[model samples]
Target chain A: MHCLWCDADMIPELSWKTIFWLSRPTYLCPPCAEQLTILKGKRCGKCSRESDEEVCPDCRWWAADAAWDDPLVRNYAVFSYNDAMKEMIAKWKYRGDYCLGKVFEGAYQTAFKQAFSFLSREAVAVPIPLSDERMHERGFNQAKMLADFLPLKTWDILTRNHSEKQSKKTRRQRVTAANPFQLTRTVKHPVILADDIYTTGSTLRHAAFVLKEHGCPAVYALTLIRG
Target chain B: MDDYELSRRYAGKLLLRHEILIDEPRFEHLLNAHYFTSETAIQTKWSHHECRRCGNQKPSLFGQIPCHHCGETHVYCRKCIEMGRVMACSLLYEWTSPDQPWPSHPNACTWEGELTTAQQKASDLIVRKIQGREKEILTWAVCGAGKTEILYPGISEALKLGMRVCIATPRADVVRELLPRLREAFSGVYIQGLYGGSLEKDGTAQLMIATTHQLLRFKQAFDVMIIDEVDAFPYTHDTSLPFAAARAKKETSTTIYLTATPRQEQQMRMARKKLPHVFIPRRFHGHPMPVPVFHMCYSLKKDLQKSQPPKAFFKWFHHRKTPGRQLLIFVPTINLAGNLTQKLAAILSNSTTMAVHASDHDREEKVQQFREKRFQILVTTTILERGVTFPSVDVAILDAGHTVFDEAALVQIAGRAGRSPSDPTGEVVFFHDGKTEAMREAVRSITRMNKRGGFH
Candidate 1:
């Protein structure tokens, strides 16, 4: 009945391919998809980020804390990509087993509660967006499942565009998908982007760029664990 | 053109394409039905037709067929023809078959051994310490101390309590080695082996043996975790993964680290504060620790520049790397390994020399060749230096002055010698043009291990 990510105007479309493959009828308007796909500013490897044109040639890579080109506010992870996480993701992403998402229903809530508890109490949890093609192949997006499981009043704010897989590309080729996201909606609170894992910080940075562009005060990320 | 030639050309050069356009009302009807059928419903009379003779198509349901040049039935349902079934459509349903699924757990150990006297003693101490103290525990003993066997009772206890146990290694080959051992140890227990390139299976195992990277897949599924190579590659340099391991385990779950060479931080933690740790000084071989030496190669460049083998280093290598002894030569780069391999192959006799690296296209074959003793001399990069050992083998670090020769790398490289009992005596040489800080650090670590393991 409702779109999971940037809760834009919801419309249900039924196709055998969509139902059997995706099992969900939600769709992302072009604008909502853009929010989850841009690169924003300079970022610290451990946390904060800033805008840069390239892997800052002079970036001091730190074992504990280094700077990345784009900065996302905070990373909020629903679960660590472990047995539990794998069990849940397999169900949601491939096996069409919706019950796995139920196990970690409270995880995202706990993260949201902690992330938004003191500062920017109005901070909202935004599930990392999946590309439409991926959502189709996977049958369901686990992030969306977590959002729905919590009924966390989430907004489908970011959209990953149709692009080559980051794995399929070299790091530089992967960077080409950087910061292309554009946002069209208005935000009422700070956004804390939620995902499964945090690796290079590229995904969160891109999503934060879009959120910041939409007048959101700040974007923070929290993952179950930082990969 | 001949028909056969034309067909061959099409098959080789062209991709087949198919396109279909469904009537709007019938498409919606099928969508509403939510199942595939031989024929979708239509709101009006059938008016569309296709000419097989001329490849002509029409959108209207009712039309005169052009290719047939006849007033015949023009509209036919493509779904119906494809299905060849009456009044039935294709239906989609989910299936839970492993095409294949990632295995939920690692195969348990088959190295069946009831706790030996020492194992039982270690087990008792470990259990008491685990329950009593939250500080570090180091099980320092000889090679046959049965470090893995000691963990068994504890692991079985955890499994009975419905807690998760995971073991991670730095190498996949090690996982392969341990899989059978684990299978026998945890008989009837559903254990998962998690590693990269592992075939997919459901994650329902109580015990999981995984590579360190696969730990990335977990989110607090384990009550406890045992890191087999705690001081091994990807673990020492990878700070994020230790945190990842912590996240994968339950908050109250204890983290047990196993290694022959615990890094300085681990030692500091054991001495300065309480941290959970364990060690096996000697291997299964009941022998003294292998002595490590540093032989500086003064004329290494002169030999290479002259397209020659470093003569002094070669002489030292030749004496040890006889027919009976095995040798592991670690070079700084693949290109260097190649150069030395060619030279060694030409000069060496009564011994075989083979080279391997991460990029070696025939890595598996080379590893097999080494195991089968097809090659007595194995020139490799740092990749194989850890997690693999050849008994009675001498270790030579050429270009040991390079920065890639880190303290950990050198120590690990030196560790490969004298691992098995049959050939407990091995040699380690560092043929460096100049000594770097890492070279000294590595030598210090080895001597420290030797002294701490005095007369083991």
Candidate 2:
């Protein structure tokens, strides 16, 4: 495998981690990852994990040097969620079918290829993991299934650590949790995070922070849609 | 073709809603199977076959034929003519002359896209039917196949032939689409898009595009009648329109039927006689038909009753809506639509949303808003199910188990999505508290239609 950070080839080493029935190569060798610099999104640098060129409100109020969380950027979506999308959503949501998800895979892959082709080779995708409680209720995180098609090492990186639905919590509560992403298992660095949807960037941004804190390289997020 | 002349020949054929009938006609399986108002004063063809040469031989097809000896045309047998029964002798000729720079210019037809093969074929058929002087034609094409374009060729043909043509539908959208096309195609020709508000009593116009209900006012103003959305809501259900179409058509003119699904009589006739019909089963963009999937929800209902949302259902729903998949939601009633709208709003708080129903007096505004995507989820009844096409919107019926959710409604609701060339296949989800036989039928029907890749 080619080392993602150093751009050098590494001797093949086997691992027990198989993301799916399609047993595929999983990671970058240690040397390349060690040399990597993790992403520290320029967030408000304090509370909100999403950031821009400026130090956002919360960080400014706290008088903190808001440079730590400064890598995240606003996401660009491929299509508007039109009436057509609403219909598809209603059908799948009401009837409880998963095969309909396949239609978006090709489109999402196409968008990803066109928009982020430069990173395709080194990008290891990690689907935003569902908490154990939600997992038991919904049986799956749709993003995980879609991520399977891409050449990425998958992981249940975020263990919910706390069981509250991330949706219910205000942006602040999610990040302050004792352990947002447990890293129960680790993966190849320079990963691309995957999820079905992105809103407020609270979940992905927090996960990105945890991964960077754990010595992972720059985290890039890819989602079907962003809001 | 004057109004009086058309009426003389077709007087006893069918009764319009206002046709001086004291009592509504009950359909009977007589020699000629058709509905007849008790008020109908039928003049049986058996009464007279007035042929100048062959007096009283057995009456041939449809009560009108040529004389055996003189080879001259004969409308009645020798008995009626001799007895002064005076059966009307009529010569039928479909005058089809393409109006070069048709008196009606192509102003209304600003579709802004290339015509599909179905539209072309329908137009050609319209021309041929006019030329052949045929009484009826069935244009069995699907909803988005663009029925308006099919009528374009017929518009000018009817005009140059000096025929007054009326294009009728059970719904307004059909008229709305056709009005512009007809306006464009027959530019110089005086045309009227008639519905309830716009009525041309002077009969000054050569063409009329109107709802079937509007046909009641005309005694026989049209020589060629094209009915759009033949199997749609009111046509088959309302006793008046079909009868009016039959009554309004001039003896020398033609009537063409355009529909994706024809009524029972049309189907039975086609099947029994194996009558050939022009079929355009796909939308103009040439995409495969949508495949409908059925999800059994009875087990999920029990789970919901246990005070838990159906995990499997949510899993499936979340996966499909995983962005970029358009959707349509159909509910049994306006109230249900409202309730579901609230639930969906709560569930998908991040997504834009809107709900629409028949009860909404501001329906036109809501529909226009939905088209613009001012609101993503347009909560609707069957009103917007079939005719309104929004690109890429997949469809689902919330309570698939309801008895009101019949085969017709299901097919219409399922047709709401994947209209754009960019995204061609629709996602159909039938969500039921308890799975019903109709749900299975709906799924199977859609699958079969799509298995042929929409060639049907």
List model 2 lDDT by residue over A12-111, tens digit each: 6445553334543323346433332222345343332345836556435334436456444333343344444544443332222333454465556666
Worst lDDT 10-window in candidate 1 chain B: B11-20
Please give the RMSD to the true structure for each candidate, in Å: 24.9, 30.0
At residue B224, what lDDT does model 1 achieve? 65
How well is each residue in B304-414 modelled by candidate 2, as lDDT tens digits?
334233454466667885356545677666666676677677877877656787546577787777777767676677778666768767676666777778765676677
Which regions of candidate 1 deviate over 4 angstroms? A1-227, B1-111, B114-121, B129-146, B276-280, B301-308
Cα lDDT for residue B448, candidate 1: 64
DockQ, candidate no. 2: 0.00
Cα lDDT of model 1 by residue, B1-456, tens digit: 333332222211101011112355754554466422222221223444432211123232112111122323223322112111111121211111111112233323344557655457666766655454243366654433346778876676555555567887767777766766777787778667766566743334667788765654344456667777677766776554565566566556666676666678777878875665444544444455555676766888776665466767767865665437777888877677888888888888667788888756688688877877777889888888666645457778877887777777777777777777577767778887888888787777666656655553
lDDT, candidate 1, A158-183, per-residue tens: 77777765546665564446564556
Instruction: In angstroms, give how far residue B65 of model 2 lies from its true place.
Output: 49
The 10 consecutive residues of candidate 2 chain B with the worst lDDT sum are B91-100
